[model samples]
Target: MNTYLQVAAADASEHRTLIITLFSVFVAATLGVTVWAGRRTKDATDYYAGGRSFSGFQNGLAISGDYMSAASFLGIAGAISLFGYDGFLYSIGFLVAWLVALLLVAEPLRNSGRFTMGDVLAYRMRQRPVRTAAGVSTIVVSIFYLLAQMVGAGALVALLLGVSGDAGKNVIVVLVGVVMILYVTIGGMKGTTWVQMIKACLLIAGTLLITFLVMLKFDFNISTLLGAAAENSGQGAAFLEPGLKYGVSTTTEIDFISLGLALVLGTAGLPHILIRFYTVPTARAARKSVIWAIGIIGAFYLMTIALGFGAAALLSRKEITESDAAGNTAAPLLAQNIGGGADSAGGAILLAVICAVAFATILAVVAGLTLASSSSFAHDLYANVIRKGKASDREEVKAARVSSILIGGVAIVLGIFAGKLNVAFLVALAFAVAASANLPTILYSLFWKRFNTTGSLWSIYGGLSSSVLLVVFSPVVSGNPSAMFPGADFQWFPLNNPGLVSIPLGFLLGWLGTVVSKNEDVDGRKYAELEVRSLTGTGAH
Candidate 1:
């Protein structure tokens, strides 16, 4: 890794030129899209849901882009390069999670929701309290996820600039925060969707190209490639097995299960992903979008195996560890090596392009997250809750813009303080929160006739509080030598992820609160109406 860094330093001038040129082109293209989108964004509907005009396929691409964050593109590959099969586990969990979204959440969410996940949750419940709870959940999840993306942006930018300091990273975080705020506040969902679509195309194309090049080196032989990867990994056949990273002990095995549960349930609850459903005109369109997203996202993850193994096979683990210690640089370094080493024209160009793609991935995702957070704040909190649903369209849009600025500012501050924390782990924590806090409430609202305002509030607050508290006390926070704060060992929780406990707890809280509260026939009637609409798409937005 030091050797690679030394080589990068030696060719800093060329790398700088290439990066600048690629970044300039990327910025120009995305900026043009934002301007065009801004022109079309007139009313609150346009700002929040792209006027509900996006085609299923287009929305699908955007969904893929939103789901496949820098963590998926770079962090997973890096994990695989370092940890082997355990890394691929994340890919499987992410893909399977879409099944939950498609079959259970997509059409119903689209049929009942207007602008945010909070919309759907508050549809049959007391509007103000439910929306307020959901608004808080949305903001919390978005902030955590946004912090991860911004930190990743900082790290990727620092790598590309060949700079090694907090100052450089802080600058990058601020720049990303500003760009994301601009994307959301100016162009809204229309601009954000287009940016995501473009980025997804580039991301898929780049991944395919890298996979093809790697296969070409092994004569397109799968067996040969696997053999080489296993041999080169220094763990021999063990590298191809599952227990190398995640299943070594009883505690780790439980943690792995918790992580898997979170990933599988989280997608349906994520505000950014859920809001994509509202971008389409019909429930059928939303369902179709999920199918398309599944296809694209599945293919992307399938190819990641090759990317990960290729990195392990071609580059020594020691060098990769030396490079960044977390293997986040593995993919870029692999591109550099397989394209012809850092000094060669092919290597330099490939590295620059990959860096640009990484930047786009971060920018697009952060924009979507900022939009989701802002929409929840403005639509659910400001417009509906505080204003009693009397806020004008223009007022709501203005609120969304202000919320975007505030959210971006908060993310920048958190990212600066986070400083080099693992992106994948942070993302998993976000998922755990979403699963624990939002998914249960959403499920009950859509399917349970007895669910009331009290149930919804309890579920949201209970799940949110439990997940956050558990994570803070879990091994990820402290106790172990590898904890984020190794010096403070206050961890009493056993698992790295709280989903195993918190998800069930969320459901239990909802059920208990509902059963214990006084019965409301009005809520029952509302659920009956919601049931019909959710099933048949009548009166749906």
Candidate 2:
């Protein structure tokens, strides 16, 4: 018995070798791709939008890779594993948000802009101010999203390697931040796109394999799987119902509505997603890309159902919670269980492989986010706003590289501070900020002729400030055990998300700022031209 137990313990402790080996292999492969892509990045066009050379299908896969972030893979799976029906609601909201993007944002955005959202917003307004607002907002929103990715990286690596201290996780977070900076600085858009596409494929394959094993175990019956999950959840029938996570209180119900609004509207405004539209050569390709992304992303979320419930059914709640109290490790744990349990070689190999795929997902995602923000800073703030559009291509690209390092540094610092938060919930806060600030300004610029620079400034600044301020004073920051600082009780805002109040206020401020300002004759002419270009792709880069 002692000899047998010794072998098992040896295997358990040494599994991290497999994880490190897999992670290093992926990192080396992606870095090779980055060096290759870096050679082709010759100018602003190449660096910013991959020279508009990507096909609809290629960009589609890249879009799916960028969209299905750690929040989707790790956080949503964890949420569903713990909360059942209410957790699945996140999947529905995320999928539906693509329709909003397709119908309202994608084609027009592709036609109207060159690199950043500022290219479109500054098209009709005063170039400097609008671009400045856009640059600031892009950095803020991308940082919020970046925090979630970093946190996931730290958690996944530390948990799989059995590192028990915050110091190890903190070190991993710094390493991830450094890697993301290298990707953006070295490869630009072409390298980032290829990394995303590869990661997307690996993530999908891993999820599918685990999902298939899960379905086979349950005899391919979803209802049977769900029933078992509920029974195992200890909440019985309540586990399969809507009130398990939300709707328990009136405040909770309203919070759900707020979250729904944010998720539904947020994708259209996200800086990284908006930038994806520019990767394709034309508006038609952009639309095609969105269609492909929706199908792939939709299928992925559907399989999340299997992964989540499968974890709930196969593992005890105590087991899931004990692995990572926030359930962040649920997916890997499920992979381990489905691969013949932890004592077996299959379990260790499967765990390491899935986590490596997840690590790939994190690296690709952070690269995209960093690229978006750095591009905004270089193109909008440094080149256009500060230099008055006279900065040369070499100078602009240099600025973007410098800014990527700085932004990555800031993300590393903030991520360590918010390391304990749920990745999905952190992403929701990002969505709320994007929807409240960027979406209102984008719609006004595209559809409303009377919209002026005053309106744009009011919308972006008002929306950004209000949403951020509310979150700072909300329960998410204090007065709750799960808050960033639970020891303090300074929360004054009631909602967990600020979308309910901030989104409407953004629209109202834009309208109010517009009707009160003098409508310029030059503005009307610019709007007419912008309308033609936005609709018909005339003068598109």
Candidate 3:
């Protein structure tokens, strides 16, 4: 009996059970929110688009919640700890994408759309076919993004509970999938937004609190922390300079550029993020939401800068190693090390908060993704394709609920399979695909009057094909021997990311296709008139 108790205590010491318990409570609270939201989900619009009643600020907060996932939270911190200056590249890249969204897409997207990005593009050109393609793209991107979050969740749970890998991730997948389904299934956009708002607040607060405390440990000296971080960051001179690693190798520069493009252009194109704009009531509200979202997300990213450096300076040696070299666990493990290395209750509280934030982040983000995919399948595909354009609101809502469950199940299974993949790389692939397939069509539909059905089709096909092919040949996919076409694993390309190449290709194809198909047959004036009314709210919604 004594030996068994000793074993239990040791497990507690290693696993940090208290943190896991706290995380469970957070999930319970989110579930309660989901239940409340379910009560409000009464019709198709409510279930699929939150009845389009959200104000700018509410929607903005929800966007932040949706955009900031495990990859941003834990993966960024881990990158900073292990890769130093290279990690900040991601932060810069991520922030740049918002600029693209604000300048090029936000108001036009809100003005043009009801549910999906496909709606925005196909509104004038070829509604049915364009909507179909957009729906396919949204689901594909959401699944990729979802799998990354699920993998991160599993890693987090296993680290916190010291459980077997499969068990820990499966628990997160089930919990997150169920909670997200409930959020969209019940409250619809309204409910999903509320949950995201609460989670975003919690996440920002938690990160800020940790950053503050870590600074306090150094007498609030920022430079001192940086110096310490530089000394401990493992890569020596490369710790402070971006191009010092591998002496500006062609491969390194290519990867860095790809990362930058993904962060910038991809932010504007993600289906889950784009759909949040629709939750707002007006185009002005959508634009306002973007500004607020930028501020909140910028502040959160700023704090991560501190958190990442703090982990490297204080816990680098203790929390990481060469064999298990990714350093993804640095953030939570560093928290534990802060208060006597997971033994003290203080450490437990910190771990619990971070873990809780992680759990909440996953639930909020995944719910939004599921909701986006569900909307695409239900409203875009089913109503338009399966129903011959006559599906009722009741049918759409029911189909949405059913689709939500199916997509969630797929994400859970995929997340489990992608257990060994890099969280950051998976997310980057989602961005690449979104930039390629969705962005070009949306942009041309809004701004270019000459864009016709052929242009839109070619853009979708070209962008989608290029992004997928690039990813297949990119280092992450090809580097894996077990991946299909293992010989392709030896990358011929320099960039690890494909957004730079794929996004431009999407735009070029759309333009070329437009030119080819516009020899006096296209009604450019009528399309421009439609766009003008949509942008200024001069016509029917």
Candidate 4:
């Protein structure tokens, strides 16, 4: 049979039909809830911040939904399928990052600001340059991250739905974008939170089901699974070990370090994640949300290991191998191979659920990202800077809605252009940028009293510039330099990830900027009061 014909025939099976039906139901319910919640939003603050009414638990679940992208769902699974134990490094690194968010950043961030991370940083300092810099960084990071998710969503839907060519992906972009915009514009934070929470539960349950079933296939004996996997691949238990390669070079070490830095530090900097902190009413609630988020996220990552390994063990090597040698399609393909072909009722249902969840994940993140971007542009840029704080809350909210439409459109266009790029790789790039640009300044502002606004600006600029430049030179960026200057394909950086280099530079620049501006500081007492209030909530606006 022709390969394309086989794929087309497999997709037309009864199992694929079941999967499609199940997925439609799940997504429809999610959209309904989001639209219902949207009706309560009346003003800008209500829309962007969900009226500051959510408790920590709700916010935390939503945060988990936001954090677990298609990369986590599909990319991690694919990585494990291809690299054995080495792929697990991604899960471990991602889980540990929450420790930073829970222990160091959460409470302080929630207590200090309103809409964007910039709001917190600029609360006590001179607003002009700092706010503008933060606004720019948030949009840039959000755009990069959004692109990866959108691309992943499109591909996942296409693969699961059996849609030929780009049609499925394009449909997904419209579906997800429209649903998410309704979630934000109509229900605001309240609606988005509920949708996210539900989606999180569904995602966790689905992953757990896949993991449990995979283990059951081996009589619940992990050792049996591991042995089979090793024998099949001839890599032994080392397939379950850290590092993708046995003998790592200096360059490889640097790359690993860079990847780790992004995973560890980027959690706090993500715009969607940061905006989540503002949903809960109190600083303590924000702290509690992080604690809950860590537990949920940790549990999900643990399951990813099972799914990835299961894919490697169950699927035929020929069928499981990715076109790019990356193992991206292993999970879904393995499911079809084992649970019954795409024609099997069970397989189709599973496929549909996975596809819907993928769609939901992208939508939730984009809504949050759009909210963050719009809030920064509308509240930080237009309201704070352009209007000199004269704009009413109503005007700010309207501007945010408009921004959402614009950003969502751009995301749709980018998603189409992104085509077949492995989403896991793109997500890593976003993480690198977030860690380099956003984390250092946030940490310094909350912990270092001597930190001045000028230092914050320097850190943001330096970090943003370095990360973007490094990514531009990486293989992924070099592969398509249509967006860059002619003949700039030369890569200055050896590693694909720039977190290790750029994150430190941000911290250093922030420190230096603080020292230089410390002498000319105005309003030390006022600054101290703001810090005190942020921690204790006595002087909160």
Candidate 5:
């Protein structure tokens, strides 16, 4: 029952110092890579899409890095450790979401857009409004996703450094923000892509190693691992079955469905992930990258079962919860235990390595997010909307760099307040907003010829506003002990996630906006051109 291993006071300082030093070295190495990549980034194309020089496998690795965020590693592993079978649902929903991206969005998005998703939406619609809406939606979604990565960084690093107070976590969050801003402004897509590829490889390797150790701990028998997790989790048989977490009440069940919907549909709409397609040379390369990504991400997610259950089997519930209430520290703590517990030199080294990988994960993800949002601002709103697409490449790239700083600042502030929520849960909010605002308009634009500016504007703004408002009033924000503001009680919406309601509303609003529009500003010729370009990649940039 006392499986929660703690370092002796004398060794704790030594462990903390080692972890910090190793982590610093990794950060410095990544920054050097970014600086080197920045030297090659000389144009708008290079800044926005990494010169489109990355091969399928490289881009796929980068995409895997972007998708397998802090939520995928720290959050989901923790979720599994704490909630058992219900926790595994997050991984399932996340992995399954990629199929939707591969089949419906990836190739077309790559073939159609140049720099940003706004490019595709603005191609046929009124340039200003659609691009503006897209830029706004991209930034909003990116910030939401960024919060999870940033918060995960705070929780993980705080635990690694043996800094128990909010002050230390907040400082780490700010440091992460500053570092990510540097990555985006200096590295652009080229730097960001390389960082992501490295992170992805490290993350997968780390996960595999831990998984192997966990299996070995149980003599490589999965059933044995599951049984130990069930017994050790304090939930007995229920820990291995449904309703341990989400099905406790009718409201919670509906919330689970909403969360599932968001996770399934959100990836296609995430600006950072979508932009990775543009880093490849051609539409075929984009498709190939996705296939590679699916394989990497799939394998990594499968190993999360071992990581999660391993933590449950090895660490007590109180140990996991007390480390961090949301269980974000479970993965790193699990690593410590399997590496010979806290007192051993092996435990300290392994813990430092895994946490360093996690820190790198946060940095890579946040940099991608900042780039996506800042690129949307520079490419869509500033160049196209404000300057009517006449801005020089240098000017636009400069604008992106400037905007990245601002966006990074906002993410840091929001992340400090959102430290208590689960990173995976925060990502679901991003997903709900993306599924509501971005995905509906994207699908309509690609498929429906009648989808015009009115439809685009309506769906985006309606979906964005509805989903955000619902979230602001939902239990995730307030009304519950686990809320962002636990003392307040403003929740009126029953579900924790808004995807179930806002997703349908988005599609319906798009149709209604087009059908009822009196302007009738349909650009038939442009639609035909877009369709041809999207299908055959004849005129694709």
Candidate 6:
């Protein structure tokens, strides 16, 4: 078996042609869709909200595609393959976060928001300051998240195309960046939505097929597969337990909790996900979309268990570890093995299909991130804050297109430098920032009658700054051998994730800022109007 894998590993170059072919097909199809959507996207409403035309089912699939990025598919599967049950926890946390989005955010956001999250947040507050704060939070979270996707794209290109060195990775990053910029600038919301919907279907189908194949190998018995995975893991039964990855010490346990908090709260504040609600016509459509998203996302996560454990059971640890230290290549390698070893025809086909799906995954996610960031800049900052809500629709749309190009350029540059950083950790940091900075302000603005512009601004800045600073000083950045800068020793912060501390601080700052302000009575008087609008969809754009 080892010799077979060795021969398969040596034959990777033979698979490159297949990978290129499938990737070309995917890019061509998506670009065609973008062209069609671009022709129809004439104004700000069409660019940002798809003219509020998506049905619940279509938006639901698009939401699933947007949420399930390369991190969810490749990252989680890789984590589970490398660390066992601890990796499965990420899937659980991500699925649970949708519940927060559905129950707490979806309907109200759809009712109050138009083009961006700032619309909902600044509805009752002073528009300029509030929109500026929301815009900053949106850009911060979107950029962090976009960096992870871009990094993943580089790694995937290197693996699939049999390329090596920084030059190859840089070329791949530029290609991804250019494609994503076009997707957002041309396709806008309508184009991006259809792209997401198509990708979602492909991803779900590919995952299902792979899961079914893995099950067939195990005689359709899940317990048998788990036992085999444990035996192959070399940790005996312990590999099936939670302590393998995240339970090293008291600090690690706290880190796990912090990560959980961020994952659960983050979805409600992700600007791209929030904006999906506005693509639908009404609050009811938004609620229905969340339900559809939860169903699709939950099913996808459940199947990831099969993909992860199947790789563990069927492939040697050394083979998976040596291919990519972070285990990002696990799923594709597993597919190659399961389809009959790398040298076989079936193996090459399966590998190419999975690679295409992964490529589509990154494309859909980065496009959504670009749209969210650009829309926040154009709609919140340029239109509302700078233009005092006097900008023409054409001007706002043009600004959004320009912003997309700038954001995509930044992501490409950062991704080239980021190299092979663990995509999962980058995603977690992005979530923590969203939970800390955006969630508190959103919750208070919608539910707290005393919440004012001062409170919202404080919450956004406090959460954003605290999360970034803590992450900079945390063990993830330095001190630990695996840290980004292993030679540096600036790890004063113990926890890798900052959610446990920063989330509470964000809420505290919001409350304190509101109480210290003199506009309490004035803000309170507006609550009745806000409440009526939020619940009844009155005066909503």
Give all TM-scores, in the order shown: 0.97, 0.97, 0.92, 0.92, 0.98, 0.97
Q: Distance (Å) between predicted and true CA of 259, model 2?
A: 0.1
lDDT of 3 by residue, 495-531 (tens): 6678888888999998898888853325466577667
TM-score: which candidate is best? 5
lDDT of 2 at 377: 99
Per-residue lDDT of candidate 1, residues 1-541 (tens digit): 4777778656656668877889989988898899899999999999999999999999999999999998888788888998888888889999999999998999988988788888777778788999999999999999989977987787777777787777988998999899888889889999999999999999999999899999999999978988898999999998889888777899889889999999999988899999999999988899999999999999999999888899999999987766666677788888888889878888888888888888899999999999999999999999999999999999999999999999999999988866656677778889999999999999999988888889999999999999999989998778866566677889899898999999999999999999999766544678888888888767756
Lowest summed lDDT window (length 10), candidate 1: 8-17
lDDT of 5 at 340: 92
Q: Tens-digit lDDT track for model 2 on 452-493? A: 999999999999999999999999889987787888999999
Q: Which candidate's lDDT is highest? A: 5
Candidate-wise lDDT, in order: 0.88, 0.91, 0.76, 0.76, 0.92, 0.88
lDDT (10s digit) by residue, model 6, range 344-416? 8888788878878988999999999999999999999999989999999999999999999998999888777
Of the two candidates 3 and 6, the one with more favorable lDDT, higher being better, is 6
Model 4 misplaced regions, further than 4 Å: 1-9, 13-20, 164-175, 234-238, 245-248, 322-326, 479-488, 518-523
Over the full model, what C-alpha lDDT does candidate 3 score relative to the true structure?
Answer: 0.76
**Please, what are the lDDT tens digits per residue for candidate 4 over residues 1-541?**
4463366357655355566676678767876887777677777767778888888888888999988887788778877777787677789988998988888888878777877888878876789788999999998898888887777666666666556566666887677667656666665677778877887987888788788888888999988987777667657677767656422677877787788889888887888898888888898889888888889989999888777888778764555543223455666665555566554666655656666666677777777777788888888888988898999988888887788788878877877766566666677888888888899988887877778878999999999998998877875555434322334467667786888889899889989988877643464665687678668766544
For candidate 4, the lDDT comes to 0.76
Q: After superposition, how far is residue 227 of candidate 3 from its true place, in Å?
A: 1.3
Question: What stretches of model 2 exceed 4 Å from their correct place?
Answer: 1-12, 521-523
Tens digits of per-residue lDDT, candidate 5, 114-222, equal 9999999988888899999999999999999999998899999877877778899999999999999999999999999999999999999999989999999999999
